[model samples]
Target: MSLIQLYDTTLRDGTQAEDISFLVADKIRVAEKLDELGIHYIEGGWPGSNPKDISFFREIKKVRLTQAKVAAFGSTRRAKTTPDKDNNIRTLIQAEPDTVTIFGKTWDFHVREALRISLEENLELINDSLAYLKNHVGEVVYDAEHFFDGYKANPDYALQTLKAAEAAGVDCIVLCDTNGGTLPHEIPAIMEKVRATVATPLGIHAHNDSECAVANSLMAVACGAVHVQGTINGFGERCGNANLCSIIPALKLKFGHECISDEQLKTLRILSRTIYEMANLIPNKHQPYVGNSAFAHKGGVHVSAIQRHPETYEHIRPELVGNVTRVLVSDLSGRSNILAKAEQFNINLDSKDPLTQEILENIKDLENRGFQFEGAEASFELLMRRALGTLRHYFSVIGFRVIDSKRHEEEKPSSEATVQVKVGGRIEHTAAEGNGPVNALDHALRKALESFYPQLRDVRLFDYKVRVLPAGKGTASMTRVLIESGDKTSRWGTVGVSDNIIDASYQALVDALLYKLVKDQEQAG
Candidate 1:
């Protein structure tokens, strides 16, 4: 297989995305993961931009990466200044990374408008920056920012910028679609011009403004670019960058390239999820390869065809990327879909069983009433278990009361809840105070059960979402609550619906605790 290098800039460019910020430790963790996945280069960050990035460079050195080289990113030296005297260049050198990536304005428009510098000065900046960094770092990768746009506007000047970096002894010149406006068909011809102009190896760094970053990157590779730059989950500024999760698999499976080992490729889905968790961002279910819904089959005709022949609906084997074919349970699901889901959950049932029909009816009825089981698999599992007569009742709620009050103007509002529950033969009553009524209820319920099931302490509520059911009623509408509860080992979701918001939240919370207790019991067995 041909070799294609994978360069990840999730730590630097990915953080430029809104609502995506990682601590120094998060960067190190992500870097380690990337190295384990056999990435060729891991861009640490712009050490000159922030103290956190500087600290990241220092800390990442402690990690002995086997396959990946850590790279520090920065920009070209300021106009009319010596590269060594420029603070950005000096700081990048001080970071002591094995590789240094510096971007310079290749577009004449940016140089004339943004930098307000002459064209010759911009070329000088690129040359000086790469030459100075090459003396300190083992490899110097020059990013020709806005290369595509620059080439379209001024082809001779764009090629000159690449020639300048090549003359400066840089290792590679990466053409960046900074504006993400370049089309896929345009990459090959442009790359042909770049190859003709410069002898250095070429890389592609694409943005997703046109929703074609992946396609553009692939086209660049087809046109002879060896290295591809992207983020783990396509996290970046504005729309995002090319998603390495999708690109890596395509490179390895489709193009017969050696980007990552088969074993490493299996961890792609988990890697994408880990980054989303660290960023505290919801994973997009519809993401191309690594998303939860990527391999999910829902329609009756599709599910039936998929069961007979796995490739009938799926483009690629889901297992090729470490993802499973999910048979989602919904109103549109057929008997075969139910049977498939039951098998996955380890709930034995015959395809022709009457219980299957009953469960399907129940699911349709519940869904029509606003219970979406597609995103609430945990709730669906519980429903299936109950229908199969295998669900165990861990506890029964006796009663609960919640109160909110603000005694003083200077103090924040406080909430208190009293919960009573019956476990086995004994009754436990407890009261707790919290920042909100739901929190208080959570605390009180956990307190009531911790004495009976010590494992309850490990189960914590991480996320809680409530949606008002559209019943054409505004204030009196029914509310649906979904609570995500987890221990250190695993997490699960439980949902509840009621006209009263607090009542709905309490029901979901109770189910969450009960689910934890059941799992603990099963494990103990």
Candidate 2:
């Protein structure tokens, strides 16, 4: 088989997903990332549809890509219109991309209903648009929209659409599962028939509404399609397009195909994360290969086995995808779990040491009381260091007081906190006001400490999460507070649990400060 081509449409179809919007600058940055990932073709948005896409096409020329060819995406000429006269075709040519892709109605149902044109006219539109675009661009791709459903609805007409594209001298004919409802089982027969009908090289463009986009894409390749079109992290309309994050690795590692170099493959996780950050979407942690939890081990047995031989639990080495193995601490943790964490933290401990068992029991007991450590590994590390008597005494909080009051119904509630602490026998006391009780407490605590540990000035709270544990206790329920703090270098999570929300927050806050102090001390050493 020839080398498979990777075509990314994140800037085009990915923006169609709900709650996703990318500026012209963002689209350019993403195109650069896709180029870095070694994708063969990038479909910039439809130049004819919107001004932003036109702006993107204008701006992207400033970037220098090494391998990828940027392609402008658009639809075929309108019914009763000539390719030269149609504005969509003219705009695509004006973009002057290295390649142009135009989707044409393939389903006879769509030709009759959506386009409201006769079957022959739709073919003419497909052939005329590609032939015209081909004269201007080095490569032209024809996307047969709803090709699978069209083939199933009317096999002969779907075959004719590919033939029309072939006659137009298209570089590739892409079969699109536009509705995303096609099952994987239905791909092999359809691809076999299509291959027999058209001499044009075939590509597969799948959607995930049936949760089979990735599977269907792989199946299409197995059935002899050489070009694959998808979006990063599967971002697209409806259930999203087939995820190149999954497809790329499967092709390279599983099928023994080289869609990208091994060095480029190592950057897959970073690419996935960068796109997520650009879209302002929280990454799906359970996403295969690139997600945070993809290689996370929490169960005691699983952790034990992976510690011996990672392949016992993981299908592939995490580092191959630029991810690391994470051991989560919970009630299910065993001695192996503690030891594994100790190794991860670079702390040496004998397997039979009593400290290991002691830490294991303490973690289990704390988890039983609703103190979660999985998301709060910083707090867990502090717990272990304190147990081993290696942690330094940064400062100790003596006591704290909080007051919240609202003067009138229309007035917002105001909170003030008073904090007292002792740093190496020097007593410091301070009070501060804030928008809420937790904010007031954090402000008061920092004010009381910054003068003693000046480096504390760099510390800031990044995220705060509060979960009510064991529901049905109403206001009396135990609350777990997880505080994420960061400075110039890095971020860490600390957790606290108590019936009092403020107290829980204070516990997390104190641990956060102590962890920062320890990190600073280690770096100085």
Residue pairs with backbone atoms closer than 3 Å in model 1 (clashes): none
Runs in model 2 with CA error above 4 Å? none
**How does residue 1 of candidate 2 score in lDDT?**
33
| Candidate 1 local lDDT, 1-525, one digit each (tens) | 679989999999999999999999899999999998899999999999999999998898899998999999999999878988999999998999989999999899999999999999988888888988888889999999999999999999999999999999999899999999999989878888888888999999999999999999999999998999999999999999999999999999889998899999999999999999999998888988889899999988889899999999998998878899999888999999898888887789898899999999999998887777776677888888889889987788899999999999999999999999998999998999987999999999999999988989998888899999989899999899998889999988888888998998997888788888777777889
RMSD in Å for all candidates: 2.0, 1.4
Lowest summed-lDDT stretch of 10 residues in model 1?
369-378
Candidate with best lDDT: 2
For each candidate, what TM-score against the reference? 0.94, 0.97
List runs of model 1 lying over 4 Å from the truth: 405-413
Model 1 steric clash total: 0
